[model samples]
Target: MASIRAEDLRIEFPLYHFARSMKKRLLGVASRRVKEDPQNRVVISALSDLNFTIESGERVALVGHNGAGKTTLLRTLAGIYEPVGGRLTVDGEIGCLIDPAAGMDGLSTGRDNIRLRGLYRGLDAAQIAALEADAGEFSGLGEFLDVPIHGYSAGMSIRLAFAVATAFQPQILLMDEWFSAGDADFMAKAQTRLEQLVKASEILVIATHDMDVVKRWCNRVIRLEAGRIVGDEVV
Candidate 1:
C-alpha cells in the first residue's frame, strides 16, 4: 500500500556566499531555523523536525503562510530535495506536479520531451506511444508538439507538462497547487483530470493556500510554521 512517514525529518539549504567567519557570526545570531551544520556550513533549515504519517486512501493538505516550507516539504517528498537530517519514507510510485516545467527541456520539442520522459520511466514502445497520444490530445498542442518548447507560451508549456505528468497513473500524487494560468476551457479539463487522478491514486498530498479547496478535496490538514508542523487534524 502507498504510504508516507517522516521521522524528525529535516531539510536544509546551504548558503554558499557566506564566508566561514560570516557564517559563524550568522549562526551565533540565528534562530532555530538557521544553523551551522556539522561541516560548519551555514544552512537554512527548510523543514525542521517534521513527523507525520499518511496512510493509503488519505487526502492530506499542507497549509501554511508563505515561506512556511510547504513547497519545500512537497519537494522533499517528491525526492527533488534530500533531507540533511532525519528520515523520510515513501512507499509507492510518486507523481509530482510541484513545478509545471520540471523534467522538461526548454530546448527540446514537446514530443521529444514526452518520449524522453517515457524512456526514463522504463515504458515500453506501446506505452510510450500511448503516453505521446495522451499528451498530444490532452495538451491540444497539435502541430506545436513538434515545435521546440522554448517557442511555446507559458500557458502552452503548462498545458503540455500537465498532460504529460498526469498521463500515467501513480500510487502517490503530490501537487503544489492547481494551475490557474491555463485558459478557462483548459482549466476545466485539468480539474476533471485531477479529480480522476485523485480518485485513482492511493495517496494525495497537496500544498495549497485555498482552504476551500482543502475542505472540498482533502480529509486531513497539516499546518506548518517555520518548517515545523504545528497542527495535524482530520476534517
Candidate 2:
C-alpha cells in the first residue's frame, strides 16, 4: 500500500554564521565593520510542526501562497530532504519530480537520459529497456533523444524530462506545477497521459497555485500559509 504520514514534521535549513557580518550572507567575505558576531547555528524554519496523512489512492492538492513550504513539503515526501524534527513514513515504490530536470544530465542525449533516469530510479537493465520504448511515446523529443540534452531547446528539454520522470511506475507520485507548461496541443496530450498515469498510482500529492487544477484533480485540498496548514478540507 502507498501511504504517507507526517507526524509533527519540522524542516529547518540551518544557516550558520561564518562571521558576524552583514555581508556574510553572500559567499564573499564581509568587512569586519559589517560583520556580526559569529554564531554556531542559525536555522530558517521552512516547515514547522507539520502533520498530515495521505492514504493510498488519495489525490491531494496542496495550495499555498508563495514561500509557504509547499515545495518543501513535497521534497520531504520524495525523501529528498530530511525533517529536522518528527518523522515521515511512505510506503511502496515512490517516483517524484520536485524538479523536472533533476535526474537528466544536460550533456547527455535524451535517449541516454531516459535510460539513465530509469537506472537512477532503481530499474534494472531489462526494465530500463522496456521504459526506453515508452520514452518515445511520452516525449516528443523526436530524433533529439539521440542528441545531447544541452543542444535541445528549453521546450525540448522539458519534454525529455517529463518522459523520463513518468517512465517509472510509482505507487506514490509527487509533482510540483509541471503538468501544464507546454503549448495547447502538447498540453492536451500530456494531460491525457497524466490521466493515464494517475489512474494507476495509489496516491498523488500535487503542489500548485492553480485553483482550477486543485478543483479538478484533487479530491482533498490542503491550504497552507506561512509554512503552516491553515485548513484541510475535502472538495
Candidate 3:
C-alpha cells in the first residue's frame, strides 16, 4: 500500500517584510505580491505544477542543481511542508534524514536525544526504552552517550543521529543526501547500514547531486529544474 502521488503540486514561500520606505513600497508594488496587498510580501514558488507517482518498491533519485527544489519536494513528501496548490498523497510511515541534527537537541545528552527523537517519531515510552540500548551501541558512543551532545564532534553527533534515525525501519525513507560522517571505519559501517535500509524499505527517495550514487542505488532518476520536473527516466 506504500505509494506517493502528486498532481500539479505547488509549494510557495511567502516572504514578509515591513514596508520601510516609499522606494521599498514602490518596488514591492511593482513585483509580484501575495494577495495584491500594499504590504511588502512576495510569494516565491518552490514547486510548480509538479506531477509524479511513485509506487511501492521503487528507489527514486531526485537529481537537481542547487535551488531546484529537491529538498523542498522531499520535505513536502515527508509531511513537513504543506502545499500551496494542487494535491499530494503519501501513504506509509515516513522516516526522513533531511538534516543530521534536525530533531536533535545539542544541549541534551545523546541518550536523552534518543528518547526525544523516538518520541518525535511517535514511539511510546516503552518502545523508546527498548530501542535505547541498541541505538546507543550502534552509535558507538559508549559512555559518551551520557555526555551532552554539545561536547561531541560532528562525526560523533551524526553517528548518534543516524543510529537513532534508522533504528526503526520505515516504509518510506527520505534522505536529502548521502551521509558522510565518523572515521573511515565508522563511515564504512554506516554505509552498509544505509544500503540495507534502502533495500529493505518499501520506497526510497533520495535527493543528491552525485550521479554515480543515483545510478548505483536508484531505479529511477527524476531531474528537476526551476521548481519543475524536466525529466524522468528509468535506470
Candidate 4:
C-alpha cells in the first residue's frame, strides 16, 4: 500500500563563502543583545522536528506562507533532498513535478526531451514510443517538438513538460504548485488533465498557496510555520 511517514524530520541548508559571511555579519549585529550560540553554523533550517503520516488515497495539501517549508517538505518527500536528521519512509513509485523543466534539457528538442524524461522515469524504449504520440498531441507544439526547447517560450515549455510528465501514471504524485503559464484555452485543458492525473494516483501531495485549489482537490490540509507543522486539519 502507498504510504508516507516522517518522524522528527529535519532538513537544513548550509551557507558558504559570501553567503556565509553575510549571514554571520547580519546575525552578529542582531545577536549582540541576544544570546548567541557558538555552535550554531550559518545554515537555514527548512524542516525541524516535523512529524506526519499520510496513507494511501489521501490527497494532502501543504499550505503555508512563503518560506514556511512547504516546497522543502515536498522536495524532501520526492527524494530530491535527504533529511538531515530523523526518519522518513515512503512506500510507492513517486512522480514529482517540483519544477516543470527539472529533467528537461533546454538545448535538446522537445521530442528528445520526451525520450530522455521517459527513460529517466524508467520507461523502456517501447513504452516511451507508445507515449510519444500522445505527448506530442497534448503539447500542441506540432513542428516545434522537432526544435530545441531553448527556442520555446515559457508557456510552450510548460506545455511540453506537462504533457511528458503526465504521460505515465504514478503511485504517488507530488506537485509544487498548479501550472499557470499557458493561455486560457490551454489552461482549461491542462487543469482537466491535471485533475484526471491526480484522481488516478494512489496518493497525491501538493504544495500551493491557492486556498480554492486546496478546498476543491485536497482532503487534508497541513499548515506549516517556521519549518514546523503548526496545524493539520481534515477537510
Best by lDDT: 1
Model 4: per-residue lDDT, tens digit, 65-101? 9989899999999988999899999999998888878
Model 3 accuracy (lDDT, Cα): 0.86
Better of 1 and 4 by lDDT: 1
Task: Say which prediction, candidate 2 or candidate 3, comes out ahead on lDDT.
Answer: 3
TM-scores, all candidates, are 0.93, 0.88, 0.90, 0.92
Question: Considering lDDT, which of the candidate structures 1 and 3 is the better prediction for this target?
Answer: 1
- When sorted by TM-score, best at the front, the candidate numbers are 1, 4, 3, 2
Ordered by lDDT, highest first, the candidates read 1, 4, 3, 2
Clashes of 4: 0
How much lDDT does candidate 2 score?
Answer: 0.79
Lowest summed lDDT over 10 consecutive residues: which window, candidate 4? Answer: 30-39
CA displacement after TM-score superposition, residue 182 of candidate 2 (Å): 2.5
- Residue 123, model 3: Cα distance from true site in angstroms: 1.5
Query: How many clashes in each structure?
Result: 0, 7, 0, 0
Which sections of candidate 4 miss by over 4 Å?
19-23, 29-40
Report the lDDT of model 4 for residue 13. Answer: 73
How would you encode candidate 3's per-residue C-alpha lDDT over 47-94 as one tens digit per residue?
889999999999999998998999999999989899978999999989
Write the number of the candidate with greater TM-score, choosing between 1 and 2. 1
lDDT of 1 by residue, 57-127 (tens): 99999999999999999989989899888999999999888876767888999999998889877999999
